[model samples]
Each structure stands twice: as C-alpha cells, then as structure tokens.
Target chain A: DAGITQSPRHKVTETGTPVTLRCHQTENHRYMYWYRQDPGHGLRLIHYSYGVKDTDKGEVSDGYSVSRSKTEDFLLTLESATSSQTSVYFCATSTGITLQETQYFGPGTRLLVL
Target chain B: ELKVEQNPLFLSMQEGKNYTIYCNYSTTSDRLYWYRQDPGKSLESLFVLLSNGAVKQEGRLMASLDTKARLSTLHITAAVHDLSATYFCAVDSWETSGSRLTFGEGTQLTVNP
Candidate 1:
C-alpha cells in the first residue's frame, strides 16, 4: 500500500444521475490514474494525470471525466451514470520515473449503476 | 494497437505440482509486470521484468521475459493452496515511459489437495 484510498468502497446508484469517485494519495506521487476492471475486460484505463491540473484521456474515456487540482487528490466524474459504467474502479499512483516508477493500486471502489 | 494474451485462463492443479503460465504480447515494449489478485481485492505486484532473458524468483514463483519472442512466463514450483489466485501480466506502453500498461486476460489458478 502506497498510502492510497478510494471513497465509496461500494456504491449502487440509478442511471441518469451524476456521480463522482475520489482517489486520495498520501505519497505525493507525480502521477495518478483511474481504471475500471470488468469480468472480460481485465483493467482498462479511463484517465490519468501527469501532474497537478494536468490530465489525459486513456483508451476507455468516452463516458468519464477527471480532475486533478492538487497533488494528492484526483476525481473521476460521470455526468450521467449509465448501466454500462457499472464496474469496479481502481485508483493507481506512480512517480513518473522511467522503468522504475511502477504503478501501485488502491483498494478499489465497487460501483453499480442501474 | 498492442495486444496481450494469456493462455489457460483457468488452471486446477494438485499441490506439489509444477506448472507455468504464459503471457504473449504484440508490439515492442521494454518492461512487463506480473501481479496477483485475490478474490475481491486489488492487484499486488509480484515481479518486474525489464529486458529479454531477465529472470526473477521469489519463493516458489519465478518469472522470465523473452523480448525477442514478445513472451513472458511465470513458473510455479510445488504449488500450494496459498498460491491460489488470479495472475495477470501487464506490458508497459511503448508510447510513454511508465505511463500505462496493457493487461492480459489473467489466469485463475487453483491448487487442490
């Protein structure tokens, strides 16, 4: 554990409602990422932040948006939740160093959108 | 697009048996990581292989990489019930340095008595 935590460990919400998941890290790492794990999909990247206030879209970023205003906090928001977005979300952190900056994962948040 | 594939999605072996899990990926990448996940938990890294022919061992588990063949293997010796979990192999993206990794399908191993 690299001092990472995700809020709403388990959540169930109805569709068409907005939702936000929070990832907080105490390691002061330079990079943060949001990923979703599904039964057949393994883990798919949704978004990542390289530094404070800097973020980039990943392979599966269509329905998700993210914000990083501070070094220790990253937020993933879904404007309107959908059934397809029901999955386990994980937050990960890295130091941004080449080769050695291996990504460490958080405990993960289990979200279900009906 | 880089593709990562792992064979034998499910394995059931008796304790004390030896088995290996194979990971194959497309494209060229310099690093690969092996991680283990128990049911209802996050992934925990087990090995980080940097180059072809790189081999690392811990306890009854060993991992090796073959960059030329775009393959990596995780060998388990004297399997134990404690080793029962889902193993995943991830290849780092070539587009960025330690930016992200493409994960394999994962192999679920069960060690039975």
Candidate 2:
C-alpha cells in the first residue's frame, strides 16, 4: 500500500447522496492523485494535488471535486453521487522532486451507487 | 489528449510459455510506466521507462520502451502460474502541469498450469 490508506474501503450509497473519500499518506509525498477504475475504462484520473491547497483537474474531473488542506491528507468529494460514478477509487502518491518519479498506489475504495 | 492502447486485452497461457503485451500511445512522451494488479488488490508498480530506449527487468518480467514509435512492451519469460494478473501501461502527459498519467485498458492474463 506504500504507506497510503483510503478510508471506507467499501461503501454502499444511494443516488444523489453526497460522499467524500479520504486519502492519507505517511510518506509526506508532495504529489497526490485520485483515480477511478472501471471494467473497460481502466483507470482515469479525477484530480491531483501538488501541495497543500493546490489542486487541479484531470481528464475525468466532472462530477467530482478534491481538496488538500494538509500535506498528508487529500479528500475527494462527490456533490451528488450518480450510478455512473460507481467504481473502484484509488489514491496514489509520488515524490515531486523529479518529473519521472514513480507513483505508489494505495488500497482502493469500492463505491457502489444504488 | 493522449490516448494509450494495449493489445490482447485478454490472454490465457500455459506455465513455462513466453508472451508479450504491447502498448501503443497516440502522442509523444519519454516516460512510461507498467503496473500489475491482482484480483481484488491494489495496483503495484512494475517498471518505469524514462528514456527512449529504457528497458527494465524484474524476476521473469521485462519491459522496454521506444519513445519514437510511442510503443512499450512487457515480455514474460517462462511464465509461471503466479504471474497471472492484469497488466497496465501508463504514459506521462507532458501537456499537463501535474504529469498526469494516461493509462491504457489493462491486459488481463491468466496462466494455466
């Protein structure tokens, strides 16, 4: 898991409900990312944070938002969950000292929207 | 936008056989990564190819990158049953500030004894 942990490993929620997933890292990496995995789409980045309070959208950022208030924690929020958003979410961290640094992933959280 | 495509989406091989998985990307990027994921488990980084001819090997797996052609290959030698897993290739997006990775649809492999 590379010292990264995602809370609520498995969750069952209803449509239109708000949900927040938390990612915490003990390695103090400078870069954090949120990705979602589906059956045929592989993994798509939702958002990424370079530092505290600095975040940017990825290719699939719609319907999702992210916040990084602390160096060790990154949060992904869904304002109103939809069935299409049901997927396995992964949190990854990397050392941003170099551009080629490898990203380490955490145990994924499985979200199911009913 | 960078698009990555992997061939042989599903593979079934016998133990002791050799196989290769190919990844092709649409755009240019010098940095490429390979990852393996087991059933119901998180993704594990396998190789990082940072140059045009970068090649990395671990255990029975070897990965190579050709940035000119935007192609990467993961070769398995004397495959074992334990090597069964889904493999993914991700290309670094230089157009983005965060070095976002664009991943290919994973290749699912099954090694039969």
Candidate 3:
C-alpha cells in the first residue's frame, strides 16, 4: 500500500554465508528502516537511513549492516549468516516530514539460516 | 535506554466482548504508535498518538496516550473475528535522531465466536 517492495521475499542460507536483502520504495520517503521480528521480541530495529548515504545503528545491529545510496533504495546485509539471524526482516519508510507521521511497511522478507 | 512493555502477552476474547491492551514505557516520550499484524504478515499502522492525553479511534479500536504516566492503551469495543491479530505498541525515542521506535513484546489476540 505504501509502494514499498522487498526483494527475495524468502531466503534460506547456510551459516557463515553472506546474505543481503533489498528494500525499494517508490514514495521517495526520506527515512527508511530495517527491522527484524522474532518470537517474544516484537520488532527490533536493525538499522535505519535518514537520507542518501546517512545511516545509523539501531538496537540490534550486531550482525547486520545497511546502506542507502538513493532515496528509493535501502539495503540490509548480513556479513555472515548465523542461526540467530534467522527471522522475518521488514522494511519501512516514512516521509520524515514530521516525527508524528506513521511508517509504512513492506511485505517483509523471511530469512532462514541453516 | 528506553524500554516498552505490554501486558497480557496473549489474549483470547469472545466475539462481541470488550477488552483493553495496556502498554507501558520506561522513559518520557510524547509519541506513541499502535500497529496490527496478521500471522506471517507485515505490520499495519493503526494509530499514532502524538501528545499527552491524545485519543484516536477507528472502527472498533481506540487508542489513548498518557504522557504523564508513560502509558498507552488500545481498547476494543465489541470485538470481532477480523480483529484477531497481534498488536504492537511502539514508543518513539526522543533522544534519537531518526525517531527510532522501541517496541513492546506485542499482544496476540484471538477472537473466537
């Protein structure tokens, strides 16, 4: 509904392998965020980008990295996959015009680490 | 650090019953949000409370925020099967630059007929 799409909707990778998930948005939102959802933990932010080339670490950024080179694209990469990294990853975008605006979420990507 | 907690991690309610989900936070924040997610689906924003004593309602769901108490509540009026889903409350970290949200554990609702 927010013109957001995530690539590789589902993926399975072996431990120690590299994995990258892509989030693309057509709304040209200024703020883009990556989050991981796990049982009993709700949704935890992995990383977020405020503008092109501007990024910051979130509460759970240990095993993940993010980059945004354009307003419409944000990428999250797991340098080396691990079993603990298996979770549903979601991409969200907000206009950033005001802090009160609600974020719009993408369909989400489910990653499995074997 | 900011912490958010939601009570009754799991709830089961009968159709047409009324209930309330409570959210409590550890720090002071003016912005609070409520979201709903179906099983295996992404979250959908339901309400955004921006200030103290803010109240918003849509359909059968109503959300209120009390900045003084650092609490928020989501009330359901005459719930239905379609309302069965996991509800999450997120608090905006005012100290953060990007409006980072600290989320609660979430409350899973099961509405049966």
Candidate 4:
C-alpha cells in the first residue's frame, strides 16, 4: 500500500519487439528499483534509480534498460523481447536516508514473449 | 558475489502448526529484510533487521538476524490459512549503501484447514 502502480499489468509480445513497462509512485520516494521474478531464480534486480535521471545497472541488466525523468515515474524497456525475458517484473520504492530500509513493491507486470 | 539461500522451498502446514524458515547468505551484511508475496500479487514488507541479534515480531510472524552467522530466520506461530504465501529474504549488498538487494529463492508456504 505504498501508492505504487505499474502499467500494462499483463503483456504478450513477439520476439524482437520493443516493450516498455511503467512504474508510477505517489510517495515521491528517492529510490526506485526494477526487478524480475522467475522460478528457481527468485527475484533479480535489473536496474535502480537513486534519483531523477540517476540510474545504475544491477546484477541482471543485460536485456533491459531503465529511465527515470521524474521522482514519481520509472520506466523499464526491453529493446528486443526474447523468450528468456518472459517473467513477472516488479517495481519497488524505498524511503531511507542511508539505505537500511524495507522496500514497498507495486502490483507487478506479467510479460510473455513469444 | 553475494549469495542468499533459503531452505524448505515449499512448506505445507496445518492452521495451528508452528514452522520456521531459514535464510543463509554467503557474504557479510548488517541488514536483512523479509517480504511476503501472495499469488499474483506484489511483495509486502514484513520485517527489517538492521544488525546482529536484531529481532522483530508482528502478530504471528517473527524474524531474527545473526550477522556473525550470516543467517536469518523467519518463525511462524500458529499459522493460519491467510498466512499462506511465498516468503523471501533479502540482504543488503556490500558494494554500495543500499544499492542492491540480493534475494533468496523464496519459500512457498501453504496453510491448510
């Protein structure tokens, strides 16, 4: 209940197509993160933005890209969709001054690549 | 590299049963977090342990962290059907301050009547 919402709750796209998922938050949190959830692998970070226009790659950032132009919106794009990219994508926001805090997540987006 | 491992990937228990889930990490970290996710829903923050020996409890759930052992545990008392969900444990990354969170494979719990 952190006032976070993800657009396109579900999507199905073909390989080689470009797809973008949006995350919007009303809490104005300074930290926003994108993650993918898969079986056996759990949730893996794709990218994170510490502030507006500031972003960094995470452990699994190969096929994904992220951009944050405002404090309330973060976007994740898949340049070319692949079968391996089919998974549940989640967006999270955190409010912490020094990084030791719990993150609240959005409802998540389910993407299928065919 | 930071590695987090959770045991009992799947758990099934009765409403009044008690259970515990374990989480182990390969590297050192001061902070640990527990999250709960229902089917097709987003993760909900359950607990945050900031240091060694940190313990927190809410309702029927309790979480503890031991930095020296590089481990954390989530204990459930008198489980209920509503508590059925997947539980995930994450640790703070050592590379940066709150930069990344390394999560475990998650434990799926099913509470029966």
Listed in order, each prediction's TM-score against the native is 0.97, 0.98, 0.98, 0.96
- lDDT (CA) for every model shown? 0.92, 0.94, 0.94, 0.93
Across all candidates, the chain A TM-score values are: 0.97, 0.97, 0.98, 0.96
lDDT of 2 by residue, B22-97 (tens): 9999998999999999999999999989998999999999999999999999999999999999999999985444
Among all windows of ten consecutive residues in candidate 2 chain A, which has the lowest summed lDDT? A94-103
Badly placed stretches (over 4 Å) of model 3 are: none
lDDT per residue for candidate 4 within A1-114, as digits (tens), equals 789999999999999999999999999899999999999988999999988998999999998999999999999999999999999999999876654568889999999999
| Weakest ten-residue segment in model 1 chain B by summed lDDT | B93-102
> Model 4 over residues B1-113: C-alpha lDDT tens digits?
89999999999999999999999999989989999999988999999899899999999999999999999999999999999999999998744534589999999999999
Which pairs of residues collide in candidate 4?
Answer: none
Candidate 1 residue lDDT tens string, A1-114 = 889999989999999999999999999999899999998778888999989988888889998999999999999999999999999999999887667557899999999999
Best by DockQ: 3
Candidate number that wins on DockQ, 2 or 3: 3
- Candidate 3 lDDT by residue in tens digits, B1-113: 99999988999999999999999999899999999999988899999999999999999999999999999999999999999999999999853457799999999999999
Q: Which scores higher on TM-score, 2 or 4?
A: 2
Per-residue lDDT of A36 in model 4:
98
> What DockQ do you compute for every candidate structure?
0.63, 0.76, 0.81, 0.70
DockQ of 4: 0.70
Residue clash pairs of candidate 2: none
